[model samples]
Target: MEAQHTPDEKIVKIEKTILRGTRPRSIGYNARKGTHGPCITDVVVRLHTDSGAWGIGPANISQEKAKGLLGSKINEIFKLPFGAFGEGIKLDLPLWDLTARILNLPLYRLLGARGKRDVQLYDASIYIDDLNLNDRQAVSLFKEEVYSGIEHGYHNFKIKVGRGSRWMEPKEGIRRDALVVRTVRETSPAGSKIMIDANMGGTLNSTLELIRLCAEYDLYWFEEPFAEDKLLNLALKSHLIDSDSKLLIADGEFHPPNYFFELVEEGLVDVVQHDFSDYGITWWRSTAAKLESWDALCAPHTWGSYIERYHHAHFAASIPNYALLEASPGKMPGIIEDGWEMKNSRLHVPNTPGAGITIEKKIFDQGLDDRSAFSLSI
Candidate 1:
């Protein structure tokens, strides 16, 4: 008979990690009307495990901070959780306060994810939201992102739409979006899934119209068709979409937790998003439990570092109702895919014990340091 490994025997220590990173120049690609911007900057965190495994996490800073200000306070100063940074900061910060002491980036991520072992991540394609761009340019941008995603061996893609898309336009916002959808769908290999997001930009009339329009495409899910506060509108949408056939997803981001809770109880939400940036890992984990009980699937709103992805992955993987994790690149292109990639859509969770991702020393050197962070027990 095989021997069972006891929990006490395998359990290890926990520690906190703070990661500092920078994207000196921001690059933006909007597919709608072919508009790209140069204003993206990022802060990354990683947790390290006692056994040396690592997970990756990223945090979002406003565009205002990283704009054209080289050698700015962005990296030269390290603000504590409740330090000089005023009320705008996430006051009860747990992880960042701990990991900042260490020099290793990936080492930090492994630890933050509660040492979950490994995380297989999904690729979230870049955004090109300029609807003003010509169709040809839109198609080209779609193909470009698709190419990049395919190169990374990813089979899923997301398209951003719906600012005034809810408006009843002569051009038909849903129809226009359909063109973008069809274009992207054509570029992928068979069996690939496509999702569309409105970014909370439409109205009641427009949302219903787009939802119906999306139905034609057979999408994997439709996210935030109405603004976060449109409870009545969401209720109406719930009435519109029969949950079993397709998903009417409401992300627990930008929107409040109460809204998600109510929606889940009513069986109105098929899929809901859980964001760590807004709630940290603890709150999101609890939210995951609630959603799981209701038989609702979850996808994390992963907008920051790869470490954030690791945190999301743990919740996404542990839940049986986990749909697809929120996918995107927290670092520059090709950083995680080359040496750190997983095979056949399955990424090896950080095996080094903690977060499992490793950052190249040269790249770490290039990262901006807003002072330095102190470490702690996770």
Candidate 2:
């Protein structure tokens, strides 16, 4: 039998565009960080082929590097199952999108459709909104946020804890952290999943105390209670076991060190949360395989870009060991996304080809107005 032939399409042009994202509400302080303003900007790179097929995704490479790929063939730069190779690895997202569109398959299907299409998602916007309020007011705000998430079809909420690390007195901070967790638990619907993130702002003793205070609330996970340390994480894991708490220990978001995987290998961490956009899909694909063997779950971080959130959704649909995705509900102007809907606390991954999103022409034109976009052609 003759070998199967593939498309000989060459990348004709590449364009880099900027998109502005706005959150529904202004994000407040976290364990260690200050207010996250209401808006953020994302830079995305789009690849156009001579065959009229194109793909787009979050951009991380320099314009010079992108220019070097101007004349590369689609098949030469990207392949199925293994994805982009060598220099093409920098263009992972766009290449994957382009290849999937060429195959007429959705991104997840192109990745083998190893998991379900309706991926579970959790609201990741619950921050420390109680910094300036009284106990009653703080609780009231927390309740309002929970109700809002429920209204928006999100049943899982991740609350930012560890107020004592920076804002208030140590004792008072722990007290407020417990208060916020309890308020969310009391206000949300039954069976709502609650997770808390400390952003590595607490010490081991303080973390343990906070956990004890919220013991009856049934948290889904304790994220970054402190930095990732072998002894500290091991002790925390032991305490959870000793107390018979079901809360999972999660870390690795803050530029995880080299020994991070060793922590997973020893069963100290229950969930792995490397940032999806920073690490890209190719890394996650390989990392997820390793985590699967180690009996750990993957829930890649999706905090800033709504575009990256979709990337994580497709990844979740393609991986069997994925935990729920972190959702930051908002609007991304200039982007036309289709087939993505939230129902019953789950975000349905679109069956459309190439990430299920297209750039609006008007928005694309406006982005080009400033002449900041980089473009290259044959």
Candidate 3:
């Protein structure tokens, strides 16, 4: 008879680091978000096992809430239902990292993914409501940003439309949205892909108008044309739009699995944008597999700092259906140890185990000096 060996580790500590930084100069305005040039405020989390192995993840969770894990065996923790403490994806990430490290495997491999050395990435520029620029000026600025992205070898680009923020009038917003697409299509290299995100910012009427306008430029996709609740409307709009134009919608982020799978089963959107920070490793792995079976594609939403970007890249590298990984590349540099650079418009996956990037201790130390910085320990 084979003897069973006892597992040696338990998750003993959980900590969250709050960091404040400036936005990258390249980022533009979102009328819906109503910010000119906003400062960055985000949280990074860490989990320590009894055996001295540790794992790190992003997204914020309350320290008191995480204390529920204290004194629990590792397996017990894993067996608990997701979001049991209302912590959501923030808790799942560190736990997955811990499990992978304990098994001496990379996070992606543990999730049954064969990591790709290079994953194609997209530059998210060309904000339609830059508050600072008029229609013509916005177009010119967008052209410049697109050229800069091309210079960096990025062939896929995303632009935000439905501008009429607090700054621009409704009529001006519509004009700018049309101009943004035309400008990018005209300026990009041959075969460059252009994607526009409405962010649920446009009315159904205006969104359909933009969809009609977008067909002329051969747009790659239209994102979140309406709200998440308007699934039927989105499906109808998808049918009404040019067959060539894809509808990209983000769902199943920071929520349970039921709705995410439902969206896929209903065929509401052509492309589903999944944010790992919101879905965590385990849930995301299952969702990705379902997407594959359903013939749907996933593009990871990368809106965080370098560490989070690396996490998204690793996930993208593992999945064959993903054609583009969203990238922000915000202002803070040297926050992570893995020298992240775009080569031929793609990021090379980190070969290390777990999430594959080391947080810069000095950066964390500096963050501690900020008034907003705080840590939770148990």
Candidate 4:
């Protein structure tokens, strides 16, 4: 008969590596940041146990901080349901991955699997590509990108706005913003969902004006038109109601103050988008529970890393009030992922154990030579 192993596994070693990859195309500017560039980098950590079990995830913990956790038991760092606490919080993703693997369950199943395995996703790569092009050229580029996303299995898109806030004249920026929205709406197939984000770069007046121009286009939501201000959000909500527009207001990705939840409670914010990696799975579970009562939904911002997108997919599969996930739409070299599938705009989470991803040791080693990496042991 096979013997059962207890949960008291001791951490024996930690391997930290760097992954560098590229987007499908060069990401242009947003309301605030400059060219996003084509390449991306992520710091990943792999945890090994004395019993030969191991798990890995994207994390940026320092050697000093990680060295202190070398000999700790797995149970001391992470627990089911509530996740990592105390110093273990820094190792949230790796710990969750390790625990789920130890139990031989998929991460979503480990989180209770209250939601569907397939979760809806929106293309988040639409940036301000019209900066140097003429009106016709800009619209053409936008159309091409949208079609490419469609070809890649996306039915919804999140278009970046607020060009007037940084790149162009205020009025022209708004006009161009409306033009892009209209072009995307008209070009995409019927029933396609469109959401706009200003990255907190617009004023109330500009937002309302853009809304008025695209009222008939049927937008899914308007995100971060401006920084988090209760009065501004209230006014925006009131305007959305008075205008009879179904556009939801989405924010909170920048780690807003505590009052943001109060806004959700008051029904002012329609969707909450705390970052998937920044907030971790435990926070998403707990926050989703709180938002359930407030009648708000979570999308959990996932813009940069494709690995983080998988993390969001598992979390989305485990929550009921999740609205939609932000899709990065790119590839990470040396990362081998299995089971998860994308059809149309929804991501079907893999039933496989431990996030369903592994690193190719040969490719990983080759890539790590030119990038930043480290290791620690007990």
lDDT of each: 0.49, 0.85, 0.65, 0.86
Q: TM-score-based ranking, best first?
A: 4, 2, 3, 1
lDDT of 2 by residue, 15-111 (tens): 8877777877899999888999788677788898998999888877777898888889977877657777778888888888888788777888777
**CA lDDT, candidate 4, residue 79:** 73
Q: Which residue segments of model 4 deviate by more than 4 Å?
A: 1-6
Q: Provide the clashing-pair count of each candidate structure.
A: 62, 0, 0, 0
Root-mean-square deviation of Cα positions for candidate 1 versus the true structure, in angstroms: 9.2
In model 2, the clashing pairs are: none
Model 4 vs. true fold: TM: 0.96
**Model 2 misses residue 302 by how many Å?**
1.3
TM-score of 2: 0.95
Q: TM-scores, in order shown? A: 0.66, 0.95, 0.82, 0.96
lDDT of 1 at 18: 36
Give the Cα error of residue 321 in candidate 3, in Å.
Answer: 3.3
Better of 1 and 4 by lDDT: 4
Predicted candidate 4 versus true structure: per-residue lDDT over 257-282, tens digit per residue: 77888888988898999877777887
Residue-level lDDT tens digits of model 1 in 1-378: 122121111102222233433332233432222333432333554333344433344534333332222122211222321111332233212233223223233322422333232344455544544356677786887787777777765667777766344332534556667767777778876776788776666656666666666665667766766655546545655556554446456556555545557876667666777565665544555566677688876676765454455445544434455666655533453234323445544454432322334456545445533343222232
